[model samples]
Target: MEENIRRNKIVGSRRFSNYFWTIFLFIGGFSFLLAGLSTYLKINLLPFANPTQLAFIPQGLVMIFYGTLSLSFSIYILLTLFWDIGSGYNEYNKLENLVKIVRKGFPGKNREILLTYPLNSIKSIGIKISEGLNPKRIVYLCLKDERKIPLTPVQQPNSISILEEEASDLAKFLDLKLENL
Candidate 1:
């Protein structure tokens, strides 16, 4: 599970599978780009290349265009994922009368996005439970601005019980109302 629900906070962290997919995307994009680049440079890198059938100039220009487009797109995805990829935490500091949500992207670069709100503005803990076949459960904080921010890890069908338990506990601990939807 990528989410951690504890007594003092709820955290949603990206999983290894997410990183794996991101890296896989990077690899595929690069492979496509590399193939395009080689073709563009009039350098045949393919194992089974028939020089007689190779169309250099025309094909090279097309490949250059394709390669540039592919690489540019891949670089965009890589940068976004690199800048905004890892962990996020939401916690309540009762003493300070504040609830804070922080999202950190690169491991130690001080790249953080923070959201803070007065504890009093937290209207309630909202629970949304969808059952049968593809059950989905979500817990959110109902704010005074009419915005709902997820407060717990989304639950799979089999984990509904645990989700409800954690959400209820959170409501109790925060001394807030729990609304079921």
Candidate 2:
């Protein structure tokens, strides 16, 4: 039966887009910072642009502000990537009659977020789909307590058919109803 089958899905946050953005931001921020510094120091810091001739009162100052903001944001994203936040696994164990969802969060008291629910508490498996500019296809676990906990990771949306099939399989394994929302 489907119930006897074990499923453990691993989710990761180290995507190509994440890496691309981090590098892009860093380079852009650093270039801006150097240009601003060149104006203040009266020295050519960047090989491509000569910012030393620019007035520091407005032009240089604006560059510095934008650079700082971008740099700070890039650092934040880098930290999240380094920590591998949101990377974890979902384990559905029929022998233990439990569904475990574990994920890594920011460093602190709740760095490791672990959630466990009894198999009986799962009322149904749900699939939510939205098409358009920001398309989203997600699978959720509908519990008896009316909580719709997402079982899928936050990433690029999966195709509708694949998502539906996964939801159906999960529903059958748990012997619960399937709801498409």
Best by lDDT: 2
Write model 2 residue lDDT over 1-181, tens digit each, in one string.
4556465555666778888888899899999999998999999999988999999989999999989888888898888889998998887878888899999999999999999999999888988998899998989999999999998888999888888888898888778899986
lDDT tens digits by residue: candidate 1, 30-67: 55455555655556555544332445466655655665
Write down the lDDT of every candidate, Cα atoms only.
0.64, 0.87
Q: Model 1 segments beyond 4 Å from truth?
A: 1-14, 38-42, 47-74, 84-86, 105-111, 129-136, 152-158
Cα distance off (Å), candidate 1, residue 15: 3.3
lDDT of 2 at 46: 96
Clashing pairs in 1: none
**RMSD in Å for all candidates:** 5.8, 1.8
**Cα TM-score of candidate 1:** 0.63
> What is the lDDT for 48 in model 1?
48
